[model samples]
Target: MNKIKPGDIVVITHNTLPRLGVVLKVHKREDPTKDIARVHLAKHNKAYNFLISDMEKIIDKNT
Candidate 1:
């Protein structure tokens, strides 16, 4: 998987349904494998926290 960063569009799966969001912040935990991310969802106008592994970057369809 590619490294995620702020401003990247990602798909978050832990929520009620898979949703698209923009990464806001990344918090690295003591265990490197358990890094967390804060994402902003435009549709809901809200932000949520999730594990980095639970999010996948969105591939540009136009490319």
Candidate 2:
């Protein structure tokens, strides 16, 4: 991925459920194996991380 940042609209599809989310923050993770992706969702108060493989491009509002 290029320089993805906070507020960028991204879709994170849940493996088990039909759900997509908007991206809130994109940052490097402490662990080398993981890149951090924060999402803004009303269903959950907390932000969730999805691996690069799990992320989909729906829109780029904040790009």
Candidate 3:
């Protein structure tokens, strides 16, 4: 998985139905591998916190 950063698009993979969101912020933990990300779901118009491990970054080839 690629490193998740603010503005990067990501998918919440922990749910039964994956939801797409844009990363807003990343909170680093003592263990770098356990970072948490703040993602904003446009559809829901709300922000949620999720473990980086539970999300998959989406790479845009058009970029």
In order, the Cα lDDT scores of the candidates are 0.86, 0.65, 0.87
lDDT of 2 by residue, 1-63 (tens): 554566566566657663466777676778744776777665686677776556766666653
Per-residue CA lDDT of candidate 1, range 1-63, in tens?
A: 888888888998876789998888989999967999999988899998889989889953333
Per residue, candidate 3 scores C-alpha lDDT tens digits across 1-63 of 576778888889997989999989999999977899999998899999999999988854236
- Which segments of candidate 1 are over 4 A away from where they belong? 59-63
Q: Which 10 consecutive residues of model 1 have the lowest summed lDDT?
A: 54-63
TM-score of 1: 0.82
Output the lDDT of residue 11, model 1: 92
Better of 2 and 3 by lDDT: 3
Residue 43 of candidate 2: its Cα lDDT? 69
Instruction: In candidate 3, list every pair of residues with a backbone clash.
Output: none
Q: What ranking emerges by TM-score with the best candidate at the front?
A: 3, 1, 2
Task: Indicate whether candidate 1 or candidate 3 has the larger TM-score.
Answer: 3
